[model samples]
Every structure is written in structure tokens, then in C-alpha cells.
Target: MSKGWWAVVAVAAATAACAKVEAPAASDAWIRLAAVPGRPAAGYFTLHGGRADTKLVGVSVASVPRVELHLSRMTVGDMMTMDATPAVDLPAGAALPFAPGGRHAMLFDVPPALTPGKTATMTFRFADGQTAAAEAKVVSAGASGPE
Candidate 1:
């Protein structure tokens, strides 16, 4: 084989190796609740991927009646808005953070008496049909700290 042909072969092999799907790292994940008046509560967290090409498909919380992934953005008129995101993509070795005024999870219809410091278990579903459970502590709205 010529030198150029060998070089091409090596590059192809490297590319293929890099393209393999890796399992997501479910550890070190957390969600913080943000205060909202007379509406559903919002939570933010960091989703870290152990390997490349992992996407978060769905999320469910036992505490809340319903949970969904929501993306909040500002419209042209400087109005804040939100919409449901089908999925949140987390590339390998990447962390997708849900923060205030950004991507977050919506916990709808929470019980009226729910309070901060309560712990809720959430199951996160990934694109590869894998599910991981994460524990989130409820905090008061505007309580900002490390997630």
C-alpha cells in the first residue's frame, strides 16, 4: 500500500472510533427550583454526558403530577416566553445546563403545600432508550447557588 493510501485508512479508522455512541454519565446531576407566582414551578440542572451523542428524550417526577422539558426565550418585543422542547441534546463530555432564563424542566400542578428542602426523584429518559434516576432538592424561588 502507498503512503497516501495508508494515511487515508488511518483517518477513516479514527473517525469511526470517534463516532461511536457512548453511555451517558448520570451522576452529579441536580435540579434547582425557581419561584414563579401562580403558575407551574420551574427547575434547572446540569445534564452531563459520559460519552458522545447522548440526548435527553424525556423527564418524569413522582412528586409533581406532570413534568416536561421547556425552553424559555425572549421574543422580539422583549417579552419572555417558553415552549416545550422535544429533547435536549448532550454531546459526549459535554454538560447541558438548565438555568434561569434558559432551558429548564417544568413541574406542573405541584401540590399546594409543597415546600423547599424536599427531595424528589426524577427519571430521565435518553434517546438510546436508557433511563437514569436523579435526586433533586426543592429550593425556594430565586435561591441561586451551585446546581
Candidate 2:
């Protein structure tokens, strides 16, 4: 009887602790304009850490076959280039911005429905085995931001 009672108490405490935990969120998340049958798309947003420092290591979305982190940069010769990045450090309370010509996520094999005015869900994977989810608005091809 005592063993049974202890098991119940432990389960209750674990559930309560998990309920109070909050996951990181993306602020102003949006994807660049891409039409159906399009090659791929890019997502831009801001991530702010809470409680402790974390690292953003990966991203996934059902709408796209594959999603990964990337960085847009200019080479010494003055040509622009985009490359895959492993991860980005996110210090607590600090905002990590992903925008044009900067750090962003590349979504490959996107679905045609991810056009402007449409909403899609994106999941960000952190190094700590925790994940954060966000909804991204597909911005117009010519638009700079979600306007």
C-alpha cells in the first residue's frame, strides 16, 4: 500500500513541474513568398531565450520536406552566398534575429499552399531536447516583412 501511494505522489509532482515550464517562441515569424511547386522557401524570425541560455540547433515543418539553419553572407570578392549553419547561441533574455541577408532557415520541398496570407506551423529544435513551436505567415515575394 505504501509503495502504491508513493508512486502516485511522484507522478503528481512531475506533472505539476512540467506544467509550469515554458518553451521558447519565435517573434514575428514569417516565410518568404513562395508559390506551390516552388523550389524552396526561407523563414525569418526572432528567438528570445528564457530562464537559461540555450542553442537553436534545428527546425522542422510538416509543410516542407526538409528545413535547416542557414546564414547569408558576403564573400571577400563581394559576392553573396548562403550556407548552412550548425547552431546559434541564445543567451537568456537576448533576442536572436533572423532576417534578409542574415541568419535564417531554409525550407526545402515546400508545399504550394505556403503563399502570402497563408499560415503554416514551424517547430524549432533546441540543443537541450526541448522544442518551441511557432506559426509563420507567408509573406509576399516582394514584401520585406509581414505587412
Candidate 3:
């Protein structure tokens, strides 16, 4: 092959290698306020994985005080319960949903300003040092999750 053609091929390979991959992202985030005041609210969202696998280590809410990852499951007695989880797996090119009766986030110490129709900033931390933040809509306790 000609030298000039070889140079062009090398540059093309380099460009493809240097292409940037999209980072993990969070979307459709929303919070459902507790039925009673002073209780923890439920947070739901959709997490889109990046080009690599990672784990969701933690979550933080700008308007709330504390947030914890949780997994809900039904016991042998046909009763449902939720327990705190340290991390949740985030596979590459997958969409993980934090919805009702499954994995979710427990937001504590939510303020009055995060009432219905309001939005709050929620940041998600990943084990790979990647972080994602999204504005979560606030919904009333009696209402279902995001439409």
C-alpha cells in the first residue's frame, strides 16, 4: 500500500479509538411523598448504563436530608418488606428501573418545599466514580408514580 494511504488508515483507526462513550445517566426521576409527614418518601427513576458495567453505590437528594438504597421483596408469609442495600448492579447498556414493589430509594427528612408539582435535584453515585444528577418530580402520596 502507498505511504499516504497507510497514514490515512492509521488516522482513521485512531479517531475511532478516541471516540468518547456516553456516560451513565438517570431519567424519569420522581418522588412520592409519604402519606404522613415526617416519614421517608419513595424515590423512583430509570438508570441507563454506560459502555461499561458498574454498581450504584449511593444516592443523595439536595432537598432531603438522607437517602438510602432499598430492595423490596415478599416474604414466605406473603408479606412485603423492604431492606437497605449497599449497592445495586448496573449492567452495561441496560436500563434499571427504580419503581414500586421493587428496588427504590428511601428519601428521609424531606422538606415542605418538595410538595406536589415541585422538583428536587437527586444525585446518583457509582462505583466507577461516575455520577449522574437529575431533577425529580414530587408527587402526592395518594398518586401513583410518574406517568
List TM-scores for all candidates, in order: 0.72, 0.80, 0.89
Candidate 1 residue-wise lDDT, 1-147, digit = tens: 799999999999999999876666554334455466546777666777866576899888776778889998999999999999989888878877877788888888877566777777778889988777777777777667433
Q: Return whichever of 1 and 2 wins on lDDT.
A: 2
Better of 1 and 3 by TM-score: 3
lDDT of 2 by residue, 1-147 (tens): 699999999999999997775566677888886544566688998997866788999988766889989999999999999999999888877888999899999988877766689888888988888788888888876788887
Candidate 3, residues 1-147, lDDT tens digits: the string is 899999999999999977977789999999999999999999999999999999999999996789999999999999999999999999999999999999999999888888898888999999999999999989999889765
Q: lDDT of model 2 at residue 112?
A: 71
Q: Please rank every candidate by TM-score, starting with the best.
A: 3, 2, 1
Q: Candidate 1's C-alpha lDDT?
A: 0.75
User: What C-alpha lDDT do the candidate models reach, one value each?
Assistant: 0.75, 0.84, 0.94
Assess candidate 1 and give its TM-score to the true structure. 0.72
In model 2, where do residues sit more than 4 Å from their true spots?
A: 1-22, 34-37
Clashing pairs in 2: 36-112
lDDT of 2: 0.84
For model 1, where is the 10-residue window of minimal lDDT? 25-34
Query: Whose lDDT is greatest here?
Result: 3
